[model samples]
Target: MRRESGRIPRRSFALLVLVLGTLTATGPLATDLYLPAFPDIARELDAPQAQIQLTLTAIMLGLSLGQLVIGPLSDAVGRRRPLLVGFALFTVASFACALVPSAPALVALRFVQGVAGASGAVIARAVVRDVFEGDEAARFFSRLMLVTGLAPLLGPVLGAQLLRFGPWQVSFVLLGAVSLVSLVVVFFALPETLPGSVRRPFRVVSLARTVWSLVRDVRFVGPALTLGLAFAMMFTYVSSFSFVSQSQFGASQQAFALMFGINTAGLMAGTQVNGFLIGRVDTSRRLAAGLCGALLAVGVLGALALGGVSGPWALVALTSVFCVMMFSVGFVLPNATTLAISSQSPAVAGTASALMGSLQFALGGGLSSLAGWTASGEASLASMAVVMGSVGLLAGGVFAVSARWAVRPAS
Candidate 1:
């Protein structure tokens, strides 16, 4: 989709990305900020572990469903209204979560928070699609990646800090405050990117048809599957790393967080490399290099796991390989997203973005859960690696096959 003719200043474009990136980061921020408080929440609410865990489940389910609803709605309504409403609701829900007396109430409110938070993740991409085309969108996505990618990984770390000063409720209070700031920013900074001229009316049957057509398009599904599965790989690694590092490898909490911080930095580094290579290197080659790097790292990881390796060397090996894998992923996500959203017509940008976002949330959750359950009790580095390797292969395979039917893999 071509942007409107007037050239947007670089400073303004960067500001726009920052605003949109924060919106995109909110879902993950809200999802993970309360994670460190789980133990306290369970104890205070007098709920079983299973019941308390439902709150996490509730938010994820809400995020997945919320994207499906809000993305298409934004296509019909225009970006500004749905987005502001979502930001407001998320802020309200964050405060409400802090005040909930019962575990069930918290779960319900978290669902609302998640649903509201979806506006940021969904429309941010649609807005990028609206405002930037081709190479510029890819570059912008790399920048957005820095915020959205880091927030959830950073959330628990920040939550652990909040616990030092106050009870678990402080996490929600902080989330509310941050989101309130986000709401204020959106009020003033973010404009309606989707104008009336290109807006699609909200019609159920028509929506279904447009979405179905998008699904049937090889171009959208290919990169989207690549994006979803790549995310599944990253999410699996992120969600499982703590358990694998500490439970199986016996790393201390500080040590694990340190290692986690380093690996996460690798992810950011990969994006920077990708950003540098955007115009110089072929996009498909960058994606291939990422997939190949992840696949190789995970293969080694799986072998170490299945071979019953252990001790400090195993720990060192795993951490090093994770850095490589995460670095590779920096290249994958932005390019994949660009391919998926940018290929679609401007009219369906919101729907397309939402569908991809939903898949990302759903697949990331589902695949990570699968790795956990498939591991039986207490996930190990090896099991996590196996899941990562399998997912990497699937992502690579899907992209390789699908790209043949439509666009070149960039190489």
Candidate 2:
């Protein structure tokens, strides 16, 4: 909605920040909180490792697909309604997942859960665009990072403790409860950020046209793909880390959780620094610099892995570099997102945001699947390192090309 002069009221702005932060954090926490329980899930469900891995894929697929639908629907209808509906579905699906008796059933439920959970991930960003532009949007996104980044750091620890005291199913139950709480809070508190005047018609051809235009637009495609590739790097690591830590490094689940927390801490630090620098540096330069740093770190880590340095400390060192690269993500993600949405009409913001989200999760899902197919406990460390490094390199290339094509010529 266009606020009078496009400025949000202070109270509305504060609430927007809280809602966006909560929504952004929920998807990651849901996906990651039970990571330490993966081994146990396989054992309890009497499923093979590959079957257990499908649950993750299902969630990712649902997330991408849901956003494709939900984002456009939000544009046609409104933000608050879609969010409430998605949260309600997510809450129910969480309970369904907790109660599922078989691995296949659980996978199916997780897919449904992901679809429902997509609202927050897609709409939160769109809502920011709805309310703010340029530097203000960048600042809002950074604030979002403050809360979203904390979830990963905290989720693993919480998951570890829950696994220690109870069955792995407890994690799903807890997620369901959290979704319910979020639903209630949003139902009462979240305003309809998308005003009716700017709402697009809900026609199939119109939606397809919006997507086609976005795909063809250099401005949208470049930043959107950059964000997607950046996310793919993280997904590759998340998908493979457990096997590497447990099989290669001989770390317990608790140990892995601790290490994961450290990496998230690095991400938080990066987000904070990026927040401070958003207004000072040009967004394009900031993204280019961050991408370069990530590329270098990942390259070095890959070299170490290739050189037969497979010890625990080596893993830790490489992981720390990965974490530092993660911090630089703050520089890239928000800026790319802001750029992607900036050129679109307000009528199509939801569709544009949806496409961006869909592309990101699609990249993530594809990479995670590839990692699962190629990984083995014996070669887990090297494989994970290679995957992360390769994704980083690919992302860097994408950003460089996008920058060259998209950046304006100097006066």
Candidate 3:
């Protein structure tokens, strides 16, 4: 039973968070670790730089579609089975990505890797929802964000070092090892969160109805859109910034890594602050505060871009603004997740988590790629600013429009 006290016997809670955080982090680690290797992969594979960005798009598509399938699948069968199966696939795909002979092949493997990695994200959220609610769930998610934030903080640096000493493939090997270790942890440390008594058998009609009901509910829809749109802003920055920094500002690989890590640290700081404010602030108010901060930073980014800022000063300016912007993102992510999941019944938490994640990756990955494509098939610092600002405005609008129905839908 979930304790409203939000206690899990300190040591056990620490272990549980570690295990779930590791699971939750797999996709991001996969995504972020390979970022520094983009130029190398493009050069070695004889592909255009623009085409290389497509690989990011493909994995995101897989992540979106995978959550749609695995979330409901876990609801019907169980989180344990789907998680194990997904991790196993992730390990295999990670290794296979190391051996692909061409960009197209690598993209195909990345899509599979993304699909597999998504099982971890969807399952982690469902597990949290299964065991916690209200303030307790929100606190746990803040902790979870701190864990996930480490991926971008460390991934690019590790990837750049690997690329410097070895090859781009070495990064994929690391991902494979991480998944293999995660498999063992899942089997030993994590237990099934979804109970058999509440599991509805996987059925097409019932699945459709459950999804429809969730989709139309503003309580769930508002926070989920809020989360997804904000993520689109973040993910576009994460996926495309290497090109922006290197191609536009003349940054080296190591410099880019450090830059990425610093911004990520800002994000973790935001989450840490959110954790401290758990009882002091309500979710909607905090979320609104975050949107305001992010939109304000987005304005700074737009001014710099529109002014045609370039060279080293532009680099310093962009990094500072990005750090401040991502700091606010830390607040947006965890609180939005808690609201959406808490609004759902545990019986369908898997589905609810899945829908949120699907929209998150799909919107996050899909629309931003167009920015790169429109910029003559290459991402630039200016284009990143423009696209993110547009999306941030849209997210703010959604949150404002949906404020009336923030409470859970009547069952």
Candidate with best TM-score: 3
lDDT per residue (tens digit) for residues 1-411 in model 3: 385322344457678789899998888899999898888999999999877888898889899999999999999998899999999999999999999999999889999998998999999999898888898889999998888888779999999999978999999999999999999999988877777888889998999999999998888999999999999999889888988888878899999999999999999999989999999999888888899999999899989888889866877888899999999999999989988999899888999999999999999989778668663778877788888999999999998888765543542
- Backbone clashes counted, model 1: 0
Model 2 clash tally? Answer: 0
The positional error of residue 389 in candidate 3, measured at the CA in angstroms, is 0.6
User: TM-scores, in order shown?
Assistant: 0.90, 0.95, 0.96
Q: Is candidate 2 or candidate 3 better by lDDT?
A: 3
* Candidate 1 error regions (>4 Å): 1-9, 36-55, 100-106, 312-315, 374-377, 407-411
Question: Could you give candidate 2's per-residue lDDT for residues 30-75 as a string of tens digits?
Answer: 8889888888998999987778778888898899999999999999
Greater-TM-score candidate between 1 and 3: 3
Q: What is the C-alpha lDDT of each candidate?
A: 0.82, 0.81, 0.89
RMSD of every prediction = 2.9, 2.0, 2.2
lDDT score of residue 368 within candidate 3: 78
Q: Candidate 3 — number of clashing residue pairs?
A: 0
Worst 10 residues of 1 by lDDT: 1-10
Q: Rank the candidates by lDDT, best first.
A: 3, 1, 2
Clashes of each: 0, 0, 0
